[model samples]
Target: MLTVNKTDLVRHHVPVTMADRFAFRLVGGLSTVASVLFSKRYGNRAVVLETVAAVPAMVSATLLHLRCLRRMVDDHGWIRTLMVEAENQRAHLMSFVAIARPSGWQRFLIVLAQGAFYNSYFLLHLLSPRTAYRVAGYMSEQAIQGYTRYLEDLESGVQTDIEAPAFAIDYWHLSPQAKISEMLVSMRADEAIHRDIQHAFADALVAGKLLPDLPATDLDAGSSIGLDEKRLDAS
Candidate 1:
């Protein structure tokens, strides 16, 4: 029988996907609705443009959200529960882009533009440790919440055949807060790196860089730098 090692225990990595972009999406969606209303109220191109801007914001946020999740699935295999979720998003975007409607492309373009803005923000934050630190603080809060929820769920009468709890107890005892903090901090650092790479890809697109015909995992290899975190040092 194999024995469990406390040292090898790791906290679950929750994806900052749609939840992270909810506010942006909600605001953008509302703005889009408002734009439509204003356009109807007064036949002004300005209102149409304002409404059109929301499309990009919504698209970019949604696409970036999916991109983030796809990376998560790559890092950790598809969790069945999220399977439908991931599929639904892809489906919606595909239909939205392909739908034959006036100004559909314009709206989608707006979404694409938002993606660029968000990606730019992600890159800027990635380059600046100070900004990343701020983001880390936010991430830490979320991590702690996830950790607590996991613990509470496990504390119930039910038990798994696996010795995960025993391992967790022993491991957490050695350096509880330190481990959690480290995991959370690492999350923030990775977020910065992801943003940076995404920005590069977005720029390439802006500069007329053709989308490469790459394998499913090709992007995985290039976009994922966190795989080497243990070997890399922070200056």
Candidate 2:
């Protein structure tokens, strides 16, 4: 597995391809509704979103690693990139757990949701890696929208911007006295990068082009970052 430094950032990365389009839009619709409903209940939503955040990346990484092992090709660092993305997302979950400790019911729900998403995404990737990447890309866009609303809520006092959780400060290497909002900003950056990374891969697959080997933090084109505790890092 590969690990790398995280950063703070979001950009606009949008492309429309047939397979990627269907997958992105299908998942995007559900995420849109989730964002609308969960934008208000910050803690609960964070738990839900983060719970399933890393599933796709982890699944993809595993599959990619296996493919490389079989083919005896390093995949030009893309596997490592995927692994780093998975780890970053898991870290996001840890940060959110500190912020919003879930109840028993929520925990059960998380288990169910995670299992379902993982299996479904696994199959999707197996059948069509390109479309699977598209799903991730679009789901991320929805998450970005959700977190953008969350930031608004914090700033407007609709949701209190509590002191950032301790783990978050350490994980992101934020200032000793960083605020929750700042943590969100840092997380948002990671999500944005992942968003682009996934979409870029999908685009390459569609175009029959070589995949980029750049770090997760460095991707081409514009992509809007989603902030959490980001989630997929929330997620």
Which predicted model would earn the best lDDT? 2
Across residues 17-86, which tens digit of lDDT does each residue of candidate 1 receive? 4432442344345446545643432113222322332232233334445655766533222122123222
- The model with the greatest TM-score is 2
Please identify model 2 stretches exceeding 4 Å from their true place.
Answer: 1-15, 32-39, 213-235
Model 2 TM-score is 0.82
Q: Which ranges of candidate 1 are over 4 A from the true structure?
A: 1-177, 211-223, 226-235
**What TM-score goes with each of the models?**
0.25, 0.82
Query: CA lDDT of 85 in candidate 2?
Result: 76
For all candidates, the clash counts are 3, 19
RMSD of each: 17.9, 6.0
TM-score of 1: 0.25
lDDT of 2 by residue, 59-147 (tens): 88788888778877767656666777777878878888888888888788889889888898999999998888888877666666666
